[model samples]
Target: MSEQALTLKQSGVRWLWVAIVIFFADIGIKLWVMDSMGYGWANRIEVLPFFNLLYVHNYGAAFSFLSDQAGWQRWLFTGIAFGVTALLIYWMSRLPAKEKWNNIAYAMIIGGAVGNVFDRVVHGFVVDYLDFFWGSYHWPAFNLADSAICIGAIMIILDGFRSKKLRTSN
Candidate 1:
């Protein structure tokens, strides 16, 4: 293959590796939490004044959106995650190798989505542990996959703004 084609292929492979790393790291952390805590809020390990490691099984989406609904939400979310991850992979494959931010963002999202999907499939719920709080207010519990997805989304938004600025400045 030509040098340019080879470079593009390499870039794609690098992004795939990033995704794999994120997926494994997320899964590893989750497994450790499950093993250590044994599942539930009863045994919380307070790490700091505002943080604690507490196990929570989220049956719904972010913040347990549809957790109260009958068991149908599990399959729905799993299907959505799979669909989104597949679309992101396709998008990443088509994106230009020079678009580093977009590529990284998509890879992170794909990795995180796949990790959560795996949990949903194997455990029937997403295992959450990380918890943050204030004197009288507490943030909803979340896991590494959620963090990755949030970071990836933020990067995508920032990249959009940067691209817009570059276009207008030209």
Candidate 2:
């Protein structure tokens, strides 16, 4: 089939399954964590020397940016998620199906964004559980949705450096 003739469904949009899977996984894990774990640093469960499943509520964007605000950040973050998802879906529709890296990256962001959006809308915040620490310092707790978004963003950045021209070996 001609690349130009491909419909949305036959294009990289097909990769949205990755988004769906990510969304469900993010939601399911959050639900499980909410039900199975205690809800704060005091209740953290050590999974390794430097890792813990520590349930937390992030009222802001990544790394809890604006978390201490007077509660306006949630709506802002939700709006941003909607915008990002729309843009990603548009990009995916234009991408060729074989462009797995790009498509998957876009889809990952979509999934993760939507998953977090779901949390923000339904729970008034994002549920975070995975925590990494060292000695007396710690990284902000995050969740699977955050991981997917970060990975997708990294993939997009890395793809920018990929060589587009195929070279014949000497």
Residue-level lDDT tens digits of model 2 in 106-161: 99999999999999999999999999999989998999999999999999988876
Candidate 1: the clashing residue pairs are none
Model 2's alpha-carbon lDDT is 0.92
List RMSD in Å for every model shown. Answer: 2.2, 3.0
Q: After superposition, how far is residue 115 of candidate 2 from its true place, in Å?
A: 0.7
> What is the C-alpha RMSD, rounded to one decimal, of candidate 1?
2.2
Q: Which pairs of residues clash in candidate 2, taking residues 3 or more apart in a chain or in different chains?
A: none
Worst 10 residues of 1 by lDDT: 5-14
Off by over 4 Å in 2: 1-6, 164-170
Per-residue lDDT of model 1, residues 9-78, tens digit only: 8554358667888899989998998887856667899899999998889999999999888889999999
